[model samples]
Target chain A: MKNNHPVDEEPPIEKPPFFNSWKGMYWLVLGNLAFMIALFYIITKIYE
Target chain B: MRPLDWIVLLGTIGFIVIYGIWKTRGSQDIEGYLKGDNSMKWWTIGLSIMATQASAITFLSTPGQAYEDGMRFVQFYFGLPIAMVIISVTVIPIFYKLNVYTAYEFLENRFDLKTRSLAALLFLVQRGLAAGITIYAPAIILSTMLGWSLTITNLVIGVVVIIYTMSGGSKAVSVTQKQQMAVMMGGMIIAGIMVVSYLPDNVGFGDAVAVAGKLGKMNVVDFNWDWKTSWDDRYNFWSGITGGLFLALSYFGTDQSQVARYLGGKSIGESRLGLLFNGLLKIPMQFMILFIGVMVFVFYQFNEPPVFFNEGTKSKLYATEHATELRTLEANYSSIFEEKKQAMQSLVSALKTEDEAAIAIAETKVENLNAAGKEVREEVKALITKAVPNAETKDTDYVFISFVMKYLPAGLVGLLLAVIFAAAMSSVASEMNALASTTVVDIYKRSINPNGSPMHYVNASKVLTIAWGIIAILFATFASMLDNLIQAVNIIGSIFYGTILGIFLVAFYFKRIKGNAVFFAAILAEVVVLYCFYFTEIAFLWFNVIGCVAVIVFGFILQTLIGKNEKELVKV
Candidate 1:
């Protein structure tokens, strides 16, 4: 149980690497886009 | 029925059990017991999450879904990757900053004790039920295929998972998951390839796909925007975006089973990467599994499958006075199916030869034959029910398993059975872990003994794991004749996820609302969601939407009514 402190004081941040890095965000978007494309291509090919 | 299959099953279990015990080493400390000392790497977290989500239903029924329906069930997960990105951005930072063990811990910090307890209570109920389905799913398939007693099968699945999970906690769950995933995927892909290879040499992959497509078993997407049509329902754009987002957010963000997996990550980046990896792989993995079902459908077109797939019911029907009638219906369906198969073959040949006229004729014949087959199957199904009054009449769950047992080679049959067990164990183990963590961290440590020794907490965690295991088995024994155990589990989650998500949303975004207001809103939201499920034509996924919106809308009304007197205390 955390000590019930006021909301104004910022909680201690663990700040693990790449918490909000551009590379992480890039890979996330890129990975999803690639997967979507692959799925679409397969479905379209099968239908065609 | 070969020695090879026995060797494979035994060897796989032996390795997983010994490896789990070796890695778990048993914990005496709460930190080690509940959180795994924050030592798991990104890959382990990734695999653990995948295993938890996969379950026996994913393996056993997914192919059947694809085989019976088509690849469109994959759309159910189209919203997952987007939801993962949303969680990584919004929920991850908040929970990590709080340094919480269970997701509910963050609820207490952001909201109040009552809100946390309510959310935890909801999770305990839903996951407790889902865990049983996960165990019961494979047990049903194995019992039906191998002719084992359902009770014995359920006990075997529960006991193996419990021993490993009790020994290792999160680490054991992760390690066994990594291995299980490798085997499960390898087994599934091999099974898919073998399906193609085992097809008549003249029927190549192209022909198999063509047959499945011609039969409407390859329909992967429905562009129609019909809210009323259950065909193009919740597994679509709107529910996928709104309701799916809410469910995924609450699950990964607040559910301890998932939260504990990431907390074991060596670093937050690793955790994020692990989640992101899941986002990338999950849809395709689901798609592939569903695609296998379509192939299985194609395989059955060439072969004369039973009018009803479940042998258990079929046998009872065979022994009854309706035996002649059922066999006659089956024989008629078989002949009609053969005619349709000829039509399908002609259609495939026409496509290759570019004969659109032949294609048209063949397509119409095939559709009519399929419609006719459904009528015959339904009659046989009715006879089965009349013969064995209380038997499971729905046979979609049996299609894929039936194919595997009748067609696959002996050694591969054993490996596939192992895959079923692995899938069941993976999901159940995670459920047991999550259930244990929620009980210990949210309820036990907070209320029962805040200052309890590490050894005492460790013991408590183990006991809770065993207790939840028994509860799940009991639920499995009585699981109603659900359409699909897979969908049933998700429906149960949908009923609760939105309200739980609403509470967490209030904690995260609605700062002015007190726990009291949100609590009332949550109960009202649940009632409203339940009403929608009962009274409206809305898909079950939309229940999440109804529930979330209800809480947010009703919460503000209650907050305004009450907060004026109390004065919104900025107690965060």
Candidate 2:
């Protein structure tokens, strides 16, 4: 919980959970967006 | 309000205010006061960011919007996740590297003092006005519905936010936001459950949703687009992805209110994770709120909805000379509801039977009756205009609150009211904190008194927080008399955001363009957007795109024209 790094220095970048790199995290977000859009599209067709 | 409702409302808001002050009581230095001493974790940053953006009008108007227009508004947030990715990859590191308090501090690092001051001033101008509306927009609606004085409602929101923000500054804002977000989401979820429970026993949850869909209120997506029509459409998929992206980028990227949220994070990873958390959850949160609206719409089908949702406005019609006419219209509305109620039953039965032809016939009957009901409502609005003269005729904003007052139990009514108050306080607190930090860091310290001690600056920040809070309260008080004031604040934000984003984009990516070129380009770009606002029929949302692109384009051209002098100057 203790933060040793000051604001001026590069704070240590930690690995994101479930992903080795930040790229996977970015894709997770984008992929979630795409999936939601598709799901919404399906809902539109079903209800409309 | 019942005594139980009053107790719940007061207890909820009082707990948040007292907890905010007490939890952050240790904050005394400038770093802690302005940026929470870089002590916030990912969840704190994420919730603070979401809470800051989710204003009182969001809680107050969004469901009403869904009741009238369906769920297409959720698309407006489509670009936010992408923007989060972009800012995380670029802007966060630069800001962290420079150790800036306000976002404009980075502009000075990247370009010149003039450019920094310019961005900061534009922010102050627009956000200062918007902070007032943040309090006023909800105050007007709450006061109207509750029959309380508008000034009292505004003061309650403004003064509570100021008390905590002034006492503990950024830490208080972030700490309290976690609770505020909980209240907002919890209150809405409970409201959603109550609405569903209020549906007729004959109608199951699936049946209610089907009814909503058949009536076209389940429209959650629209991919159809053409250049001519789509440019003006604000909430379609394409505009949402592109235009919404630019708007979010400007908002979360450059807007001090938002920047302050993540800038309080303990590390780069925490800030990045915080934004990504929002990107992933913000849409679903909006969808949940809009879905509650859809359910409210369906509930109205089996039950009688008020002919006009704003009972306050409708009541004004009774004292006027057109009172007789209004009574007749109400009669017509009641009869139409009877017919529509029967038609809706048939539609539900037909859907259950899975008979296409029967379904079509029932759907048509329901649609026709719905149209008739709509006509009666429109006539009532017209009558209200003629009869009350100055009454606001649009009732979409009143739909959800009216339902809560009319249907929800006493304790839940207080909880819902707490939800709105929590939302307003959360947003106002962030704006007050951000406004104070920007004034102190970007303007006061840099220009007026650079030699002040850290404690002196913290005191100055607390004073400025109170000052901005008072200004916002005053603005909200007077702004209620103006028409379309929310739209006015939004226009001001859009006009400035694009140019600010452009300057930041130039700073981050267009490194070849120096400070003077981009600064002038930003001014010129803002003028072009202003011209579009005043002269062209272009939608205001596009001003963000135009202003952003114009800055980069003009920055290039200006740099090319003055390359020799700039290069020489740089060498010197």
Candidate 3:
């Protein structure tokens, strides 16, 4: 069965999903945290 | 250097040329010539894109970078996969939808004629000069290492590339690139294995990494964000996401060299997949190359290497009066370097045992000793340069090739040389093709003759390819003057990529912005980016961010202000 949406209507703009969103600003913050955590882990391993 | 090796080198080169010409025999028209009649597959496009970006610089310098630094260089590519996904979804659909020849072609339709022209011109100048440097870079290595004349090396690179590029155009480039990529990957893997095999029997692969780790060559990732220090400039999360995004966007979305690669794709999905393929493979491929370099560094530590890696300069220096000074410096370097190597092994053992105090002691001594060894090597290299006035003394560029020559077997050496040649040829061929395409399509065909025959345009492209080939040779020869040829070309790109990207961004997003406003804004932004590059010490990567943002913000402001005034004045 066909949907009732108008043919000429503009499609909704999709947001970049929680992990990939916000000026990519949040993504940047989380990414830095992850990288630091990983780096420190490597350093600790290397030291050990 | 053996008869069989020579045979392999000549045979590989001969087959690529003949096969290329045979496959693309009748590609005489402009569309067939430049775009392979738009019938390439996804895998072919993916390989072609990889080949174009991985020039001889990748083979020659990346290992040197690894040997000097470590696997940390691999992090620079961390953002590439994500960048690829973004391009595939947003940028890919637009170009495919437009059915454009050059990426710049879409700018005219989206914005205005001037916008297209401005972007096209920027690509031409930057790419044309860079194409020369690529050709020149490999030639410098071949000539210096083989003790051949620079002129001969330059001509060989130019003539060999021109023959295939002019003969088969884009089709020849893509097909040959497939073979080239295979050979390059195979050769590098073998070279990496050979480095391990050449190690002392006591030092297995694990031990080598331990040795490398002790020497501080195993530090693959740096977390500190000290902006002022250029030495540890890892592609951080922010730079990778923001700057890398803009760079990938401008490069794939605008640059003709790359656009031409995908333009040959048969369908939109194929082209998009090809790009996605690159995004997947590039980071890991870079990691492998850097890892190979780390192994080379470990190999050198176990076996004493030359004071200066460039054998060409060492030979000339030995023949001169300054030989005595250089020899003394080398003797000093030999002893200190050995001690440093021992210190590295101790550090590794300390780390293995989880002895905190021993680790601290070993790390400090190892660092100090490593610093002293570097100082002595520099002093020796300086003496070598003083000994031979006219000799080219940059040894970092020669580190990998020197290893290849000293260690790799006879036939494998030829294969690796061919790999370097193939890498250089693939990149140079694409640049020549893209340069010709942009020249004929954007400037000549549009402005000079809007209705020229395909035959006529094809002929013009061949002529332009040869002309640019000559230009590249000249650039390649002089490229030695620059401290690092790879960095020099990249610096040039950083200056122009952002503004061009900005213009493209405005065309895609700013629906209300017209061509003239964006075009002028591009000009203004380019000047500012250049000023930042010259006057400021901001790392070259940051320039991409500055250029892209400046153009977008400036274009919008100019567009809105002019747009509003025009409407108000019209009402009056």
- For model 3, residues B1-572, the per-residue Cα lDDT tens digits are 77777787788878887877777776367777888877787788999999998999889988988888776666655555666666666776788788778898898888877778888899999998888788888887888787788778888878888988998888889988888898899989999888899987666777677666766676666555664675225355456555666777778778999988987887766676687678767866887788899898878776788888888778778888878887788888889888977876776677667697998898888779778888988787677666666666566778899988887888987888888888888899999989988988888998888887888999988999999898988877776556776677777787899999888787777787787678888988999998988887776777888898898888888988899999999999
Per-residue alpha-carbon lDDT of candidate 1 for residues A1-48, written as tens digits (9 for 90 to 100): 222323323332233344466456646655774567466547646764
In angstroms, give how far residue B343 of model 1 lies from its true place. Answer: 1.8
The global Cα lDDT (0 to 1) of model 2 is 0.90
TM-score of 1: 0.93
Compose the digit string of candidate 1's lDDT tens values, residues B148-250.
9888898999988899888878878888999999989999998899888777767889877777777777676654476456532756545665566677776
With candidate 1 superimposed using the best TM-score fit, by how many Å does residue B195's alpha carbon deviate from the native? 0.7
Question: Of 1 and 2, which scores higher on DockQ?
Answer: 2
As for candidate 1, its clashing pairs are A6-B572, A7-B572, B67-B293
Global local distance difference test of model 3: 0.78
Model 1, residue B50: what's the lDDT?
89
User: Worst ten-residue run, lDDT, model 3 chain B?
Assistant: B230-239
Ranking by lDDT: 2, 1, 3
Error of 2 at B56 (Å): 1.1
Select the stronger candidate by lDDT from 2 and 3: 2
* lDDT string, candidate 2, B451-568, tens digits: 9999999999999999999999999999843444334555678898999999999998888998889989999999999999899876667888998999999999998878988678
Give me candidate 2's interface root-mean-square deviation.
5.1
